[model samples]
Structure formats: C-alpha cells, structure tokens
Target: MAHAARGADAVENDAEGLRRRVAALLEAHWDEARGYSVPNPSIYPHLWLWDSCFHAIVWAALDDPRALRELEATLDGQLASGLVPHMRYGDAGPDTWLGPLERTSSLTQPPMYGHAARVLADRGSRPADELLTRAVRGLDWLWERRRTELGLVYVVHPWEAGNDHAPRWDDWGAPGRTRADYDRAARTAWNKARMHDVTFAADGSAEWSSSFVACPAGFNAYVAFNLAELAELLDDAVLAGRAAALAEAIDEHLWDEEEQLWADLAVVGGGASARSPTSEGVMPALVTTDRARALAALRQLDDPDRFGAPFGPANVTRTHPAYDPDMYWRGPAWPPLSYLFWVAFARLGLHDAAAGLRARTIRAAWRSGFAEYWNPEDGRGLGAVPQTWAGLVLAMGA
Candidate 1:
C-alpha cells in the first residue's frame, strides 16, 4: 500500500507540473489582438489554423476562457467565401510574400475548426449553436471551393497541407525535382489559377485553373471526421450524409489493398497520380468504421521498421528513402501527431499501445521542455522549443 500510494503521488505531481508548464506557455503566446494564440512566440508569430485549433483544444481541456477566444479570433479571419487562411499575421510582423496582397495566405490548412469548435462546445466553453454556425460555414466553404470531382478535397500548396517539406511533395509538379523547383512550379500554378479567377461556383464546383492539387489521405480523413462532428452538433442530415460519402470516397480512392494502408493521390492533368505513403496516411484509420480495415491500418503502427520506431511513429516511415530523423516533417515525431495517434489507439481498443505512446510523449516533453518535435531514433527534442502543441502533453495526460 505504501509503494502504490507513493506511485499515485508521483503521478499527481507530474500532472500538476505538466498543467503549470502548459498554462505558462499558453499565456506567453496569447496575442492581445482578440486573444488569438500563436503556435510559437518567436518562430511562428502568426495565428495558424491547425495550431489555433490545437491551442483551443488544450485550453478547453483546462476549461480556460481563452479557448473560446482562440476559435472566435480564428473565425474572424475567415474569407467571404468561407475559406480560412492557414496563417493570419498581425500588423507588426515582418513583411511576407503575401504582404503585397492580403495579409492572409490564399491557401488553407486542414479543416480542423469544426473539430475544435465541437470540442469547445462539448466542454461548454462556447454555445453549440454559435460554434455550429461557424463550423458549417467552414465546411460549406471546403465542399464548395476545394472538393474535386473525385469527391475528395485537394490542397493546392504544400504549406496548406500542414506537412510542409514532407516526402509526399517531393515530386509535386515534376518527378526528380528539388524542393525549390517544386515550390516555383507550385507558385506559378497558383498564380495562374488565381489569374484565371478560380473561385467556388454556385453549383458546388470549384472553377480551378491550377494543375497543382493533391488529395492527401490524412487530410481528407481529418475533414471527414470533423464534418461528422459538425453534423452531429448541427443535427444536419445533409452534412452527415456528405461526411459518410467522403469517408467512403477516401477508402475507395486512397486505400492501397496490397499495402493495407492509406496513401495520397495527386490530381495531375485531371487524372490520379501514383500513390505516396507517409506516416500521416495512417490517420484515416482513426475514423474508419470498418473493423478489418482499421485493424490492418493500425498494424502499420506496430511495425518496427515502419512507424513503430523506439520514439515514433515517425512523420515518415523508416523504410522510405527520404527518411531523415532530423528533418522536420520528413521523419521527426511531432507531439500533436503522436497525441492524435494515441487517441486513435485508445478509441480502437488498443489501450496498452495508447498508454505506452502517452508515456513516451510525456517523457520526451519533460526532457525537452516542449520542443516542436523529437528525434524518433534518439528521443532528442528538435525544432522550436516550448512549442504550443508540445504543451498538448498536458491535455493528453488529462
């Protein structure tokens, strides 16, 4: 009894320490402008879509009022067409490429606002109706402006995918190309698309003029899951149906039967490109209702040579030629992604796996003081120190 009591006391102390650290980090990054939360105070001063969503989620876990403000501030940056920019910079920042035009980038990150809003609403941080309205608008925007004929939404830029510099974009525009070359081609395609007046049509079709587009499995899964959550919040049958259909489309189009995993497909010249697999590809399994398929996908997480590295689930698989432990998204283990997979594992009844991952993540954060990511091989923290999502460890523990 004495030993068990001591262990329990240690756990409580650790939890308190995590909560204190997260609260301090959140306070540090809270922008005065409508209480928007930045991903990092220095490295990423701008309000990032997914980062804000994550910030709100962790805040909601603590029942903080800043949670509501974070979502509302992000909503204020939404465009008239319902497309929320991936990054919204404050007026004081150094001039960026988009400074000549709108301060917000035309591109967008994963549609996670709906998911974040739903989480906040569930925690009673905001009114369900208000959050539902905002979420539906964002969903409608994606369905109208980003959806392809194949029934999946496509991202026009690598940054918009939130897995910038990932191996998946290595051959974005042309095979055997460098990152700089791909960026130039993507930029040129984006400009042409904008010049041609690409916009969402009244008939639910996108008047796209860009050749650079990709339907990433992980991104589409996130959209589908969030749409389902929004549908439940709003009790909207149409959105629910669309969400189901989208999930089906992802399975049909992105799942590789032989590999037993989900992969990304680039829409090039109105046709599907070859399949590209990354650690993000496993995300679809999180939302999959098909037991067999979900189990198969989860199996990849247990493969030591693949995602089950000592400190991973690396961002890219170990077997991939482009695997580099120090590279940002190419192979490093991010806390956000690890937390997400932990949730998925728990939901899928892989409780032991989930608990193990949670232990690893907590230890890594404790060792590194919330670094952006960790080296999957050595468990060494990398990237921005004291990252916002790295503080997500607090919520994960809760």
Candidate 2:
C-alpha cells in the first residue's frame, strides 16, 4: 500500500510538471496579435492554420481562455472566399520569404479548424454558435473552391497536406531538395497561379497545371470528421448528408482491401496512380465506420516492419524502400501524429495500445524538451524545439 501510494504521488507530480510546461511553452509562443500561437518562438514565428488548431486543443485542455482567441486569430486571416491561408505573417518580419505583397499564403492546411473549434466549445472554453458559424463558412469555402466532383477535396500543394516530405509525395517531386528550395519553387509557383485565377476570375476557376494535385486519404478523413462535427453543432441535415456522402466516397475511392489500408490517389499529372503506402495514408482509418476494416487497418500499426517502431509508430512503413527514420516525415515519429493515433486507438477500444502510446509520447516529449519530432529507432529528438503540438502531451491527462 505504501509503494502504491508513492507511485500515485509520482504520477500526480509528473502531471503537474507537464501542466506547467504546457503553460510556459504556449505563453512563450503567443504572438502579440491576440490569439495567434506560433509553432516555435525562434524558428516558426508566424501563425499556422493547423498548428493553431493543435494549440487550441492544448489550451482548451488547460482551461485557458486563449484557446478561443487562437481559433479567432486564424479565422482573421481567412480570405473573402472563406479560404484560410496555411500561414499568416503579421507586418512582414525580417525572415519573411514571400515578399511584402501578401501577408498569407494562398494555400490552406488540412481541414482541422472546425474540429478544433468544436473541441474548444465542447470544453466550454468558447460559445458553440459563434465557432460553428465560422466553421460552416470555412467549410462552405472549401466545398466551393477545393472539393472535386468525386466528393473528396484536393490539395494543390504537398505542404497543404501537412505531411511534408511524406513518401506519398515522392513522385510529386518533393524529396531530395531543401525545404526552403521546394517551397520557393513548387509551392510558390502553384500559389501564384491559384491567386491569379481566384483574383481575376469571377467563378474562381483556378486551373492547376502542375501535376501535384492529389486527394489524400488522411486529409479527406479530417474534412469528413470536421463536417460531421459541424453538422451536429448546427443540427443541419444537409451538412450531415454531405458528411456521410464524403465519408462513403473516401472509403470507396481510397480504401485498399487487399493491402488493408487507405491510400492517396492522384488527381493531376506527375503523381502516381497508386501512392506509396505510408502512415499518413492509414490515418483515415481513425474515422472509418466499418468495424472489420478499421480493425484490419489498425493491425498495420502493430506490424514491426510497418508503422511499429521501438519508440512509437513511424511516419512511413519500415519495410518501405523510402523509409528514413532521420528524414522529416518519411519515417520520424511526430508528437501530433502520435496523439492522433492515440485518440483513434482509444476510440476503437484499444485501451492498452492507446495507454502505451500515450506513455511513450509523453516520455519522448519530456526527454526532448518538446522537439518537433523524434527518431523512431532511438528516440532522439529532432527538428524545431518547443514545437506547438508537442504540448499535446498534456492532453493525455485530460
């Protein structure tokens, strides 16, 4: 009994420490602009779309009112069409690379804003009506401008998918170049063309000649999840119907029965008809309604030669020829992705797996001081330190 009490006390102390760390990290990155939370203080000083979503989740978990402000700040950058840019630079800092004309990029990140806003409102950190209204407008914008006839929305740039350098984008010509060069060349060119069409054309017909457009399975899953959440909040049958239809479309088009996983499909030239199997592809299984299929897909997370690694799940299958534990998204285990996997596992009743992953993730972040990602093989922290989503470790306590 004494030993058990000591163990419980240790756990309590650890939780307290994590709470303090989350507060410090978030406050350190809080931009002067009301709710904007930078991913990192020194490295990423601008507000990012999905990063802010994760920040909101962390803040809401801590009962911080700043969570609502973070969501509102991101929405402030939303375009007239309701399309939110991937990142917004306020006042053009010294490190601003895109020049002084535009404060934000034309492209957007994964559709996690609605889901994040719902999370905050559910926690009583924000009003549901206000956030849901903003979410619906953003969803409408995406449906109008990005959704394909096939039902799944398409990403014109790999960065928009938030899995930059993933094996799925290998054929789209993303690897082997510095991230700076890749952004300046492929991303900049695509954004410029998109901006031109959206600015000059009345119908907003932006034709992407580049072969990088793709319907990523993970991205569509996020869209469907967000739409369903918004539909529930608004009690709108039409939005609910759209969400169901989109979910069905994803299962039909992206699911691979033979491989027992989901994969991306190219919507433009230059991309492979069949994307290489990666952890990002299997992420959609989290929202899958098919029990047997979801179970089968979850098995991939346990395969030693696939996502299963010594420390956590790798971003790409270990057996894949392109797997690189040291590379950014090719194989490194990211805290945000790991947190998503934990949520899915817990929802699927895989409590033991989820608990184990939560422990590993929290331990890794603690050891690395909130680095952007970690080596799945040795658990060595890499990339930006004090990353925004690294604070997701605190959510385990909630």
Candidate 3:
C-alpha cells in the first residue's frame, strides 16, 4: 500500500510538471508583439476563443486582472451582430487550413463569455457592472444569432459545433476532410481518418500533431451554457422572457427522444444533412437544464457501450464504428469538454457529479500529461499532449 501510494505521488508530480510545461508553452508561443489577440495556443498560432478562454485560465494564475484583460482583448474582434468568430488571423505564419478566412473575416466561438465572465467574477477588482454588462452583450449576441431550427443553437461550421462527429453523423455522409496541401495528401488522409484532420504522424511513429480545424463539441456546449446563464441574467423583463423562451425551446427541441442524446440538429436539408451526437450536444443537460431528459442524456456517459471511459467522457459513444481511440475529437477524453461538464453539473446543483467528474478529469490530465485528447480507456496522451486548454482546466480545476 505504501508503495502504491508512492507511485501515485510520482504520477501526480509528473502531471504537475507537464501542466507547468504546457502553460509555459502557451506563454512562450504567444505573439506578444501582435497585441495578444492572435497566435493563440489551442488551435495553432492564431487567435481563437477556445484557446483564449483557456489562456485566460492560466493568466488568471499569473495576474487575475491580466486574465480578464486577455478576454477583453478578444472581445474587440466581435462582428457586427456581436458574433465572435472562432478565430482571428495573426501576422503571416505557417500556411494552414482556415488560414485564408482567418486573414479576411472576423468570426468568434460559441458564446462562452460566461466562462470568461465567471473568471472575472472571481476578481473583485473589476467592477461587477462592467463585467456583467460585457458578458450580457455577448449573451445578447447569442440570443440574437446562432439558433437553429427547433430552438437549439445552429453552428454553421464544424469548428463552432466542437464535437464534430456525434452519432447522428453516421446516418449522414461522414464529414469529408481536405488534404493539407499538395505535398501531404497521405498524411492529411491519415489525419482525416485517425487524427482530427488537424494533425498527423509525419512518418508514422505515433507522434500526434494537429492542424487548424475546430471541433464541434467545444463550441455547441459553450453556447448551451452561455444562453442558460443569459436567461438568468438578462435585466430587462422582456429580454429575460425571450431568453427563457429560447432556453425552453432548446430543451424541448433538442431533447432527442430516440437516441437519448442531443444531436447538433436534424440535418434533413441537403446543405445541413449531417447530424451527430457531438459532445457539445450533451451540454444542454450539462449547462442549460436539469430535467430528467437532460439527466438521461448524461446517462449516455455510463453506457459502457457508448461513452463510459476509464479516463473521462469520450467525444463520441463507442457504439459508433467511427469510434477510434486515437482519433482526435472522434473518441478521446478531452479536458475542456470535461471541464465544461464539471462546471455545468455544479451549476445544476449536481455537486457530487461535478466533483466526481472533476476528480476523474484531474486524474486523466495527470495520466495523459495534459494532452489535447487522451485514450478513453488507457489514458495515453493522444494529440498534442500539453495542449493549452487541458492545462487551463487543470490549473483552474474547472
């Protein structure tokens, strides 16, 4: 028993070291001269809210006020309707997918302002009104935009959806991935099938890497939680009424009676004919409502056949054939998704569930060394171990 305890201690120490190193990588990779708005860590050397929020988590430790500033810096990029694009382009760097759009357009992530806002909420220095007001603006944007048919938020692109391949996609055609460039079709193909199409094995040595694609689960769940909070925070009775109505609509519409999992949307139309049970989809229960149906959706987690994992929740249920343990977003225990689940459970008063998941996530992070994603069963680090968001979750215990 003593030896086992020592082993556990050693593992914890190794995990802590990895977390520290990941944080250092984030700071070092940050293009400070570019005003901190670009060159984010998670999605590559570009400014992305997904990375920025996690970046805020670490910066919170170094300087709480600066952490809040980090979020504020990203806010400046909001589009006309307050739509925050998933990413903003920095000065020329490596040629990457979504590279062209990043240079030309201004887009944002799903409204995850609440996560960042709550972080600011922890800092008494920022005026509550200021923090709440900015957060409310972002929430208002989500209310105005991003909703799909049947009231659930509709993310136009995969990046916004976060959990790319929920079970629903199996019925529709699998999402086709693009080749990286003329030089690396095989590597890109390998990435499309095995990795998240973001990275791949340069020479087949199990060296996990990523490219510039986004995940659907990360963004969908973000809006689910943000909108739920907006329903509570909107000051105007009319706006509050609208927010509540939208929230309820989401619950009713998204609560899939058949699968018992929330799908991205019913993809009947030719353009949107790809439905999936993205990790982000489960977020309605995780963040918005605590109804029995929502809870049932989470029960999918225990479906040893579907999502149950020794480390943390897999991005997709195992019942799906696409379920590849090493596939980046397809089947892995990711920190950000788990962190969102952890907090969502807490918000819904499921403290025990939240704590249990938190503990599991911490262990997974330690075991996987804070990788971008880990094997759900073996806890081996998969893509970009020491990815920014994984480290952020560990540091904040989110």
* Model 3 lDDT tens row, 1-398: 23322343355545455456556756665555654533325546666766676666666655535566667756656554555556666655434343223342333455666656555555443425665566667666655554555554444334445444434443333442221221244434432443233221222111112222222333545665565554454434654565466556656555556667654443332223234454555776644454776677666665677787878788777777557667666677878778777766666677777666766666676667567788888777776645667655555352
Q: What is the lDDT of residue 337 in candidate 1?
A: 85
Kindly provide the TM-score of model 1 when superposed on the true structure, using C-alpha atoms. Answer: 0.86
Error in Å for residue 360 of model 2: 1.3
TM-score winner between candidates 2 and 3? 2
Candidates in order have lDDT scores of 0.72, 0.73, 0.55
Q: Candidate 2's residue-wise lDDT over 1-398, tens digit each?
A: 23322343245348788788789888888876556788977778788888888888899988998888888887777766677777887555424232222667666787677778767768876545765676788778767777888888887766678886677766655543344444435655644443443321232223243556788888887777778777776678977887888788888889877677888988774466247777776677667788787777777777887788866788888987777787787788898788878877876898888888888777677655677898888667778975878899887647
The C-alpha stretches of model 1 lying farther than 4 A from their native spots are 1-13, 92-101, 173-209, 269-274
- Give the distance in Å from residue 97's predicted Cα in candidate 2 to where it truly belongs: 7.1
Worst 10 residues of 2 by lDDT: 198-207
Order the candidate numbers by TM-score, best to worst.
2, 1, 3
Give the range of the ten consecutive residues with the poorest summed lDDT in model 1. 1-10
Per-prediction TM-score to the true structure, in the order listed:
0.86, 0.87, 0.75
By summed lDDT, the worst window of 10 consecutive residues in model 3 runs over: 200-209
lDDT of 1 by residue, 45-94 (tens): 78888888888888888779888888877776777677776777776643
Predictions ranked by lDDT, top down?
2, 1, 3
Question: What lDDT is obtained when candidate 2 is compared to the true structure?
Answer: 0.73
* Structure candidate 1, residue pairs in collision: none
The residue ranges of model 3 lying beyond 4 angstroms of the native Cα positions read 1-26, 35-43, 61-63, 93-107, 125-135, 165-221, 230-239, 267-275, 287-290, 395-398
